[model samples]
Target chain A: MHRLILLLALFGYLPAFTQYKPLDASTINRIKEGVAEAARTTNTISSDFTQEKEMTILKDRILTSGKFFFKKEQQLRWEYTHPFSYTIVIRDDEITIRDEGEVRSFNTQANRVFAEVNRIIIGSVRGTLLDDTGFKASYTQSNGNYIVRLTPLLVTLQESLQEIVIYFSKADFTVDKLELFEPAGDFTRITFSTKKLNQPLSNEIFSLY
Target chain B: MRSFLFTSIGLLLLLSGCQSIPPRHLTPVSHHLPSDTFLPTAHCTLPTFFSPPTFQRALFKASMDIREHHLTGLLFIKMIPQLRSSRCDNDTVSLPAYRIVCSNELGMTYFDLEVAPGVFRLNYCFEPLNKNALWRILETDFRLLLSPEAGTTPIKTFVQEESNYLVCKSKQGGISRWDLYSPMGDTLLEVRGKSSLADPSWISYAEYHREFPFRINISNPLIKLKLSLSLLSLN
Candidate 1:
């Protein structure tokens, strides 16, 4: 199920290194407030995403593209349509996956990995990860984006994950890209595009069936 | 007194029957072909599917079923290029290096391994698959699937006129392996090895595309493991 988390976290923006500097305390507070306010009003989100994964042993970067969907409370659907077809839907502590033509379901509370993925992805979409005590967060500004770097403080997560960097648009406080770095020099970046927020999403999309 | 003697005899028989029985070892080949048709072939060549000369890399949609667990993922295989100075004249030289990586649908790796003749290195493996027995099983499976050129081992050939197929038998490390091929020996149909316990492990190939098998299924009944690979693309 690590793949499920990766496909969800891989929505990313371009890595054009513009001038970046540390944000002042006041600005940081304002950005946080803005993001929290945005999260409160955003009841739904739908977007197309592109993901890239880099590994030392691979001859080239693995590229994948997918669609992402989220609703209020705890409902999400991450679907990969490129290279291969895979779909993962999470609702109310349950995960349903569809690979090729096979379908399987698992309870998040019964599996540690699934539980973690559920928490992380929901926290990410709700803009609540910044306040998570499991990580230490730092703030920076680059051109029109606020970069939040979160370092894992939990020993278990630190074994596999080094840090997570989230790029939020200054104009709307919406996340544009997310990058996850591993201690083993592997990383995944996901960029979201064509984002539609607070739009009416069909209830059938979250069905376990 | 007679009842006591019968109980003792029963206990003794039970203990004798329960004495630890050694596991049945697998043989190299097992087939029921007639021995009269055996021929001493001077030369043997592997089919194009097993030949590594023209293959560089490929990708597949892979699935493995072991015990009660099922795993689906992407499998990438790349042949490592050897340096010019390491070239050898012997037909059965050390096997060429091949790097294989299996990852989940989205990109989380299950394991990464580098395999060659007498050289097996596990670069990375997921926690659940880190068992020594599992790794050894994978090593043996890959070694058999990606065998070296056929000339490296002395082989005896037999022709089954009724079945219109040829069988080549080769023994290594005292285990006999048999390869079943078409009459012309251009396409490999199946590979099987002998076993002392149950049915022999076997690999079957089908759905050829451009002289390569698009579907490959490997089964080891003793371990209750079945691994299948379907070609996705040639990378």
Candidate 2:
């Protein structure tokens, strides 16, 4: 009877302890290999982006169309061409935003929030999102797409963002959609279409105006 | 020594009592109008008008530095008969539209278009004042207190007095009063009233500076919107 009671207690606590156990060595190696393969396969990423922002105060949702350009070694540019003209370029550790004729630049290291955003964007582009220790990731296969759901580990991030869901094409593992949900019931859904991978891109494309 | 100490303490207490005495209250002047008549119509009309010869339409552009937020934008306005008209075809224009018609006798404004598409109708009646008074009223009341309408009427007006003043009340509960000086005060424009139908009870105010046409100060009881408008000439 004593042995049975001890066994039952141990079984009850085993599930909780196993919840955060490290991924198996083989799984970790597979993820790294997949990331390396994706990085090498994708030299330049160009895609048409459609962003929908649902504002909390306004009943209407704003639809914006833009183009996204990305190159290896963390160079990205988001150029909005319709509805209004705005461009956000991230090169190295600096971000420059140009709207109309005005230009504003800020360093990622100086702005912690922007730095985190840069890291997440870079990680997502490189298929290394699973390496971010600040989030717990679970993958699901849906409609020939890999859906990665990231839940924030920190309370502050969790308060602002409930979850970030990223969808990548299963055929080539290219990110096609990213949905961010804010705690205030607001959401931003960005969809990528006509994605061209491994295109030749010049460094001048990321130059600030 | 005991006698001397008691006398000093009594004198100190008396002095403290004199210092703590309440200030004399005087009866305030009864400037409130009777229940039947809230606003006085004595100085109902403005004195005169300063008519410029030609009406020019130009695209105005400016950059605003609003604290830390900067904005730039362009506005196209046409100086019409007695009113400054703006094109309302674009949904980007944020303010209301009004048709301002000024004649020798009175100045009339038509508010809330679409019922009578672009038709000018009599709205507010401004009695004629002198050119100086008109300039003062324009600077103080019309230019500053009123918002530049894109499709709505300017409803509120102000008349400046020494310290105490009378204000006409709008049916929507907005108050209009004019100042004694220029049409555009230190601040080019000032708008004070509830802007939206949702919050009819709340009072909001906006101030625009002539020097910085791109910057605006908007404040309500709850929040403040310091908007900067930067204009990039697409031309």
Best by DockQ: 1
* Tens-digit lDDT string for candidate 1 (B143-222): 66776334566876655545656666775332346677776666778776532223245778899878889999987665
lDDT, candidates in the order shown: 0.72, 0.49
Q: Which ranges of candidate 2 are over 4 A from the true structure?
A: A1-35, A55-59, B1-156, B159-189, B192-225, B229-235
Q: Alpha-carbon error at B106 in model 2, in Å?
A: 51
i-RMS for every candidate: 2.2, 19.5
- In Å, residue A17's CA in model 2 sits off its true spot by 27
DockQ of each: 0.25, 0.02
Poorest 10 consecutive residues by lDDT, candidate 2 chain A: A53-62
Least accurate 10 contiguous residues by lDDT in model 2 chain B? B104-113
Every model's TM-score: 0.77, 0.49
Pairs that collide in candidate 1 are: A10-A190, A11-A190, A11-A191, A12-A190, A12-A191, B28-B175, B28-B176, B28-B177, B29-B176
Candidate 1: C-alpha lDDT: 0.72
Reference contacts preserved by each model: 0.05, 0.00
Best by lDDT: 1
